[model samples]
Target chain A: MNLPQPLQELIDQFESLPGIGRKSAAKLAFYLLNVPQDRLNRFSQALTDLKVKTHKCDRCFNLTENKRCSLCEDEGRDQSLLCVVEEVTDLLVIEQTRKFNGLYHVLYGRIDPLNNLGPEEILAPQLLSRLVKEGGKIKEIILATNPNMEGETTAMYLKSKLEELRTKKSLDFKISRLAYGLPMGASLEYADYGTLIQALDHRNGF
Target chain B: MNLPQPLQELIDQFESLPGIGRKSAAKLAFYLLNVPQDRLNRFSQALTDLKVKTHKCDRCFNLTENKRCSLCEDEGRDQSLLCVVEEVTDLLVIEQTRKFNGLYHVLYGRIDPLNNLGPEEILAPQLLSRLVKEGGKIKEIILATNPNMEGETTAMYLKSKLEELRTKKSLDFKISRLAYGLPMGASLEYADYGTLIQALDHRNGF
Candidate 1:
């Protein structure tokens, strides 16, 4: 008697996604319905496959299809330098440039006290442990976390924690945060390629 | 040395969706990777199931799981009055109010000559045949097509065609169109419920 219940249900599901409101969700649902059955199937399968086939690298926390991420497994990469980011997408953006030969550590999220997300909620502990355990091979740690309030706070927290680890172990590896010339509050994912490259070039000691 | 090739491919596919764009698509793809496998499967299956489960109603051309749409099958509906719309989504909007007990005919699209979409492209022939085939049981045809140029042109074309049909059959039935006091160039999907109801109430004979 009304819109097919399944169609409405799907539209509601889409609306629940981040950045999608009611109107956009409805349009997306209708567009999906109109797509060819094969394309829809492929799109759906891709969503399911993303979860089934991919996982966080135990070492760096970047998404991977194997036990360790491609960066960690690649012998040609500069193992002495590591770039840390807030999410896997950030890693992908940096990777697209073909400039960074270092490994990456995905925090999975940034520290947001307002959202009840703290240092422990992210992969901070694991990242610190990896740096300490592999202190001999890694000469520098690049804090490429996003240039936002939460990102700055998280970077500061990690910097202090890594400093404590270095003092306790008598290690001398350098730790640095990304440059702040980028527009404030802008996500690393949306930063222009040139801005990201410039930020990476101007990174300084934390 | 980066995100897996398949994962990158999947993100590119998400970007291809309408209104998804690059940044939002990456977010969605990453979100998909983070979601539980079972939940991702359900979302993916829903996408494919939407098109597979729904089919055009033979009688009204509305999206339905059966031969006749729920509105057409309902016993309480006033079969004497029919509300014609451009799409199934539009029909759903009117049905949400529970005020119109009449049946519906979905033309699927309007007559857009500029886009090479004419009457034959949107099931107009079937609509006219249905009106004539209903015999004297149908007393009124309410045109609830949109208010855009294509909508207006389609309504006028349908009005002239229906008039010819009435003259040929020697029948007496009122033909009307929903009022246009609402804003122009806005889709029926975006119209508030109150506005749509008022437009229906103030409908004028074509």
Candidate 2:
């Protein structure tokens, strides 16, 4: 318990992160202690620079090293299709799939009524503004929030909001939700009841 | 992919830590972004000071802010008893039990042959010197390494080495390995064969 304040502080900082607990934080701190001094310095420098260097992409709210995110500026991606995700991590996951070729709008968070995070706390306004600013250039809006309860609520809210925008602004874009079904290669036995119901309800022709 | 260099660097550094990968690293980095700037600055300062503030206690090789670790300097602990462990984490685990009132000698690592880690790489020599310097003042040594393969090998090596030291220095201390048995409340049916055998071999007279 008599650790140097800095070492203890490092452990506390690590514990403050999402998944790390006391033991894991201590393990990481000790691991850092063994790491070469220059690497530790670089790591510290990186942490300091993370605050000084990075900012959100003004256009899409995506994190960027620049004034705008690469996805927002990329000419090759479809400008007419935008995927709305709850976070940049989701964007990265979708990017990994290589199936979606559209631009993204990272909401940073979804509506969680229990946690008191409403539409206002997240990037809902930015999303609306982005859609309006792009206008007829965007032909489709994909509601790609997570599949959980909050995500479902957020998707419904966005659906109504987008529908209102379409009616008021006469926007020429369509709104769609990501499909729900058993994941690829997953067995029906292991699939939960709700997922099975979704798979059954959304069955497609052979 | 065009993340600002500092954010990317922080992600890379987070990824370098044990158990943290690319996605978790990115999540931590992004989470740090939303954290208040002063908090981030404090985290950065903590990381920077970790190296500057911490050092190994010369006596036990345990991490400390000073020349000696708290356990090594505590007057209330039994100086006659020393528990040898592979890491500080192990020391912490033993301390949590509150069953032992002895000092510790942290090996800092186990003798992992497959990883090419030998006695020389760890703090085996320091344990030997400490034992010699303390001589007849120390009454017992508990080899409290973990119950795994690497820990077992390390314990065996330490036992033999300490025996040699006892003979050379004419030390009058008892060297004991921690008892092996079925963990408290664990079912005999669930116990593995090796563990059952150990429990049977070390069974006490009722």
Residue-level lDDT of model 1, residues B131-197, one tens digit each, is: 7787878889998899778998999999999899999998778999875556678798899887788
Best by DockQ: 2
Q: Candidate 2 has which clashing residue pairs, if any?
A: A65-B4
Quality class of the docking in candidate 1, CAPRI style: acceptable
Task: Report per-prediction Cα RMSD to one decimal.
Answer: 6.7, 3.4
The reply for model 1, stretches above 4 Å from the true place, is: A96-99, A110-120, A146-153, A181-206, B96-99, B181-206
Compose the digit string of candidate 2's lDDT tens values, residues A1-206. 45677888999999999989988898899899878888988887887778677778898878787789888878999989999999887887888888998898889899999999999988888888877887789999999999999999999999999899888888988899899999999988899999999999999999
Off by over 4 Å in 2: A1-4, A111-119, A147-171, A180-183, A186-206, B1-4, B110-118, B146-170, B190-194
Residue pairs whose backbone atoms clash in candidate 1: none
